[model samples]
Target chain A: MTMPSTPRPGGRSARIQAAVHQAVRELQKEQERAELTVPAIANRADVTPSTIYRRWGDLAQLLADVAIEQLQPDQPPADTGSLQGDLRAWLIEYFEEMSSAPGRAMLRDVLGTPGHANAGKCDGFLRQQIEAINERALARQEVPIDPEKVIQIVVAPLLYRILFANDTPTTQAVEALFERLTMPTKT
Target chain B: MTMPSTPRPGGRSARIQAAVHQAVRELQKEQERAELTVPAIANRADVTPSTIYRRWGDLAQLLADVAIEQLQPDQPPADTGSLQGDLRAWLIEYFEEMSSAPGRAMLRDVLGTPGHANAGKCDGFLRQQIEAINERALARQEVPIDPEKVIQIVVAPLLYRILFANDTPTTQAVEALFERLTMPTKT
Candidate 1:
């Protein structure tokens, strides 16, 4: 799942990319992804349709790009001097964001879009985030566990509730999940 | 979440119900749930649409009934005389079934149907199965753990892979998940 590179910072081309991404997110909030069109997005962003075509190739590519951008953390959660604290903070923030209206709409678009295999892209982003946190822990001389194990223990259940069960995870559920994951192992 | 009662055994009505259920499953394999209709099901089952309506109330109700029926084990996985063995066996079977074509179709219908709210029904069935296993473990004098905890460790990851990531959990992944869950916790 190779994601599209983020546009280079500070230029006319970068500005257009930003505007287009914002338009895509705003449109997702207003309607399902099935209803979005390149022309409509061009109109929303005040860019020409040919410009979007030249840049994005098609509607699916454009939507995929937007989905990936929304998933990237504004800034990765700050380190809290312990792996457990970092994980808890990161996940709590993630859960809260995912439960917000805009977040839910973004998720629906990513997951429910026809013929767009965005799950792998999302999964890759999750793996990268967990790996980054584990790297921080390793630097602090804390033992690093498999990021996959962390995902199974922490991220999977919260997502299961959100997508399949249509339930927002409670703070207590988050805490319980973290506790179970970080509990001392028996010899 | 009140699942329809399974019909009693050995009668003409039971026979019709069985035919209808079989028809539903076969049709699910053949087409998406959105394409299913009472008349179509009746034609496949060689029964009257009136019979389907009289018995199941609506297409959504009929579909839900079929889903629950398929999900219910002929007999829940046998106790392997240890909690770990029992859990591993149950989950491996569950993982295989859910990744099967029929199972995936049923899951999609249960999750994707508008106004169908089948999550509670599915959740209830899972909790019931877990409790039954726990009771058997307690009879053997094994310590009981929170069923919700077990769900988080075992079921959630497998499901997340299937529905969100589009990955059928590898055997290695399943084993790792179980090992993590069963690792002894410090007091």
Candidate 2:
């Protein structure tokens, strides 16, 4: 059978999208504690297997899209008017989302998926959302650092802990990350 | 029917392992720009389907183990008598490896697979390896940074560019990352 096409529109399509996303979230919650599958999610969501495969291209892509949709738009980390303040605020928000149970679960799934590098469009959606905040930090010029690099510095450990070690991102870990990132070196 | 079990004898086991790894690698190369599957690999390797399924525990796990086996052992950064020097050297090596065509391609595949997180024990092996290096860096006081945070500082941009943004990790990116991590901030 042919796979369904992208989540395109009519009233029915939007409704399906909503249902699928909700199903994805619920499945993700289950995923946090156990395993998940399209058939299982379909049974729960009451959508057919053809409906999922046809619309989303694949299970991972669908979930990544749904997860991206769930991410809150990046905010201009508090205007503490300092790079450190901005970074702290930015990272706190970023990590809080990442460290949350759902976020952690989603990340674990994303990194665990094979052939993820080819999923560039989805990754771009997430990165751009992050980069916008980094750009804001750059405009402030309170800290003389590359905005992209700063974003990477702040977010990397949280992702690593969640995906690899299955550990929570602690405050001490965050603080240390911040300090080392900002310390001067022989640039 | 039960999956194929491991080879029965020592020499046979080694032969089986070598054949499996070779098959997996060749399959990866063949599917460099497309999707890969167990049947395709089995056909190419001239192995029975049961043998592949039994030994690798499915495609993702099999591939993850192959990738993990391919990773080089981490080397201590040259003791240039300074944390920055040592860290720079170490990270440069990391940056180089992660940016290499094969490295990026393989990683993308690892991240691309849906349900990749369930890949037996090899799912997070690479990240754990990176974490180990971070721990070593801390113990050696080579970077004088908190050990835990070091993983994020070094890896975030590398993976972000490779996995998310579709950019090859570059010397400039590594240098910029180094600067961000080394800059002084409000202690």
Candidate 3:
């Protein structure tokens, strides 16, 4: 079967994106069972090893792209009119997604690659995602700070607990998080 | 050279732990340059491939074991009574350790392995580190809740931000984390 565009100029970006996503899905599946290689992914995506390499930096980068794409929730959590509701929904869903095999693999790949540690890129991307949720919280007048930082503070612990502490965010823990972030300061 | 070990019947556990840590350090160095192998690690640690595999479960497991060992930090931050001082010290030191190459590698290994999703292990390990500081805070009557829970909530974001968001905990951000967590509740 003809795969999508390769990572080149012209019509290649879309095709390349599709091919890369497919390759990532395949690699993620393999990662669940065992380690994956560039050749194996190339074969599955029906692309050449050189083509895959040329497009992405390496297997890690390719995997990273796929992981990021997939790691993002399909859409931000719906605005529930309250900051607590919105954050709860967002965090619980986000945590559940990260706990998935693909989600976990993507997290591992991102964490694995050293060059991926560009804070500006990571912050901008995170701020963007949090902004979407933040805007909703703002519209509802539920959030107290810039929605972006609020989101980071609210949801960050979920990802952290999962990745570092290895603890899933229990309902109690999520509520605790909500209470901690959204509470008005006692002056 | 012989390393320290616990006196126990299953000398295997301590031996294996040392081997795994050594292997992880070597592999991570190689991974930085994009070339790592079970054999290379085996050679560096002077252990047979069979021994490495037998002890750690697989290459990923061996990699994970080494990385996992680093997750447990040495001690908690000094509690100087003020939340800001305690948190800033805690976060900066913690992030500095985890944000470094070795810390990043350990985070990656934890994410790489599927079986490590158990956060209970992480919580227990971190509580010990956090308690060292939390205890100091408690002695000074600095915190409101259980020191363990406070530690978890306070430090969770730092670890989370680093591994998943690929961001470091800035001094300002650390302050924000403390401010939010330390805010008095409706209770």
Candidate 4:
């Protein structure tokens, strides 16, 4: 558990990792989470269970490694006319995706991973998305708000509700957060 | 994982559950998390491994049940007169406790549990703590903010930091959040 999860692999390692990851993704689509043990994944991946244990430390770490990769945005955040528009659009998408059944499972994998490295890597995706939007805002001559503040104001609450609260978070809640963040402060 | 975790029990069930839970708590102290197999726990509890699996489904559910119970405050949140004072003191202490190593593991257990029932139960504790503080505020004739909003503003951020962020949250950060929450609104 103290060992670092190889979330990102390279060169020769990528081949084995990809096979194992693909096995995980397909199995996740096909069966129950309780059935997703290390031996099952290793068998499907054509590798020994010892390989999984040696590389990922355990099943949770392996799932986390796969989840962190999948959760990454395939492309950068789309540009909108205004920073407000861009941020709102991005957050709405983020919230909806994370609230979906499959998305929640991915979230559980990353957060449940005992080593925080995978979680930290996932955090980077949010910052990157925000930065992309902020860069566009700066280009448009609008003052860019800090990414950390956006994370605190929006992402935290959405995730908290998604994982812990019995009720699902509504898209309107994300909108409300965006409005609250963008509205001019009274002096 | 699909079955409900026996987070609380009544009558005769309590005796066996207590034995199992106490064994888990003690074993957690003595061994690595990876070494805590159902057989080991059952052996310590003086029950068969089948008993552990039959009752709890898996180690995650059993661990989650224990975690949610330990998270419950032994006493109610202390009254510090005003809602602001009470909330600030309460959140600061909460932030510290939850950020501790053992606290993070407990949080992981609750969040990682597949059923989500345990996680929801843990959420109730936060809401209950807030209600206690707000009741005191009402007695003093001071307006009490929504408990949900307090959770949204403070608890969400603190937990996001504790569970996901690479760095730990600071007491000063809690104070800053409290100030923002209590600050006068500009029209």
How do the residues A99-145 of candidate 2 rate in per-residue lDDT, one tens digit apiece? Answer: 77667545544554445432355455445554554566567653345
Name the lDDT value of residue B91 in candidate 1. Answer: 79
Question: Which candidate wins on lDDT?
Answer: 4
Task: Give the 10-residue window scoring lowest on summed lDDT in candidate 3 chain A.
Answer: A1-10
- List ranges where model 3 is wrong by over 4 Å: A1-17, A23-32, A73-89, A117-126, A133-145, A170-176, A179-187, B1-20, B23-33, B73-92, B117-122, B133-145, B170-176, B179-187
Candidate 2 lDDT for residue A164: 50
Q: Each prediction's Cα RMSD? A: 7.3, 7.0, 6.0, 3.2
C-alpha lDDT values of all predictions: 0.73, 0.60, 0.61, 0.83
Q: Which prediction has the highest DockQ against the true structure?
A: 4
True contacts kept of each: 0.39, 0.42, 0.46, 0.75
Per-residue lDDT tens digits of candidate 4, residues B1-187? 3434443567556767888999999999998888988999999999998878888888888898889889988887888877788889999999888888888889888888676787888788999898888788878887777887787788898888888885577989888777768532222
Among all windows of 10 consecutive residues in model 2 chain B, the one with the lowest summed lDDT is B114-123
- Give the Cα error of residue A5 in candidate 1, in Å: 11
Q: What is the TM-score of chain A alone in each candidate?
A: 0.78, 0.68, 0.75, 0.90
Across A60-152, the per-residue lDDT of candidate 4 in tens digits comes to 888888898898888877787888888888898888898888888988888876767878888889999889887888788888878878988
- For candidate 1, give the lDDT of residue B187: 34
Q: Candidate 3 on B1-187: residue-level lDDT in tens?
A: 1223243545866666676577667666666545666778778777788876665566656565555556656556676665446655766676677777677666666566556543345556666755676566556666534544455556766765665566776777666666655432322
Provide the clash count, candidate 4: 0
Off by over 4 Å in 4: A1-11, A183-187, B1-12, B183-187
Q: What would the TM-scores of all predictions be?
A: 0.63, 0.66, 0.71, 0.92
Interface RMSD of 2: 4.7
